[model samples]
Target: MPQCAIITCNNTHRRTKGGNVRYHRFPGDHNTRTRWLQVCGKTVPNCSTARVCSRHFSKECYERDVQHELLGLPSRCRLKKGAVPDTNLPLDFLKEEVLPGSAIDILLAVGLVPSQPVQKVSGGLPRE
Candidate 1:
C-alpha cells in the first residue's frame, strides 16, 4: 500500500479507519509538479511516485459530475484538471527544497524530516 505523501497524513487504502479516501498522484509536468511541491511544503527526490490524499483538497477541486450521488450508489470522485491541493492543507506541512548550501541540501544530506508534524487529518482509506 502507498502512504499519503502529505507529511502529516497517515491515510492508506486499508478498509478500516474512516470509510473511503482518494489519493491523487503528483502531476507529471515539471511546472505543475513544482506547484504541487510548493503547496505541499515538501521536497521529494521523485515527484512521479508522490501522492496527495483527497482530504487535502477542497470541494471545488473535484469534478462537478462526481459531486452528486444517487441514493445507495457509491460516491465517485475526481479532481478537476489543473487542480492544486489547497483546502485543509498546511503551508508548513514540511520543509521545502531550495538552492544548494541552503537548509534544503543540509536536510537532504542529513536525511532529516521535520522534527514533529503540527497536525494530522484523519480520513478513510482509498477505494483503489
Candidate 2:
C-alpha cells in the first residue's frame, strides 16, 4: 500500500470513519509541491513517489459529485485539477532550518554524520 507521506497521518488506501480515502500524488509543479511539503512539515528531497491522503484536504478541493459516483468502486475520490492540500495540516511542520556551517553540527548531534569523511569513489559518471 502507498503510505501517506505525512509523518503523523495514518491514512492509506483503506476505508476509514470518513469513508474511502484517496492518495494523491505530489504535484509535478515545483511550487505546488513546495506548498504541500510546507503543509505536511516535510522536507522530502525528492517527491516523485510522494502522496498525500484525502484527509488532509478540505471539501472544496474535491469534486464530491464525481467522487460520489464511484463510491463502491475500488477507485473513489476524484479531485479538481491543480488541487493542493489546504486543511487538517500542521502550520509549523518543518524542523528548525539548518543554518550555514551548522548542518554537520546538528547531524553529529543526532549521530547521522560519519566520524570521518567518506572516500570518494572514482568509478562512477565521468566529470564534465
Candidate 3:
C-alpha cells in the first residue's frame, strides 16, 4: 500500500482499481536522488521510504516495449532513467473559494496591500 510522497497527491498503489498505478522509489545514486529532490521539492533527509506514484509523471516516462506486451505484463511499468515528474499541479493548489469582502479588504487581511492612503501626484500618477 505504498502512497505518493507528495502531501498534495493521494494516489496509492494499493487503491488503484486495475493495478494500473506504478510506484517508484527514490534513486540510490546521490546525484540522481538530488535531482529527484529538486524536481519534487522535497527536503526529507532519508528518501528510502519516500515513494512517488506514476501519476506524477508524464506518459513518456514509462517503457512500452513489445516484449512487455507479449508477456501480458501488468500495467505497472518502470520509468525511464533521468525522467522527471511533469504532471499537472497538485490538487491543493486548485482551490478557488472567494471570500465575502472587497479585494482591498482581503489584501489587507493578508498584509498584501498597504493600509496607508497613497497620495496622488498632480498628473494623477502615484508618486515614487
Query: What are the per-residue Cα lDDT tens digits for candidate 3 across 67-100?
Result: 7678997454777787766675454333357577
- Residue pairs in collision within model 1: 21-125
Q: For residues 15-121, write the lDDT of model 1, one tens digit per residue.
A: 42466678888876778777788776567767777788888888988876533464546657777778888766665643365447977668878888656534544
lDDT of each: 0.71, 0.71, 0.73
RMSD score of candidate 2 (Å)? 12.9
Name the weakest run of 10 consecutive residues (lDDT summed) in model 2.
91-100
- Which of the two candidates, 1 or 3, achieves a greater lDDT against the reference? 3
**lDDT (10s digit) by residue, model 2, range 12-50:** 665454566678888878787777787777566668887
- What are the runs in model 2 whose C-alpha is more than 4 Å off? 13-19, 64-76, 91-128
Clashes of each: 1, 1, 0
- Give stretches of model 3 more than 4 Å off: 13-19, 71-76, 89-128
Question: How much lDDT does candidate 1 score?
Answer: 0.71
In candidate 1, where is summed lDDT lowest over 10 consecutive residues?
Answer: 119-128
Q: Estimate each model's TM-score.
A: 0.57, 0.54, 0.58
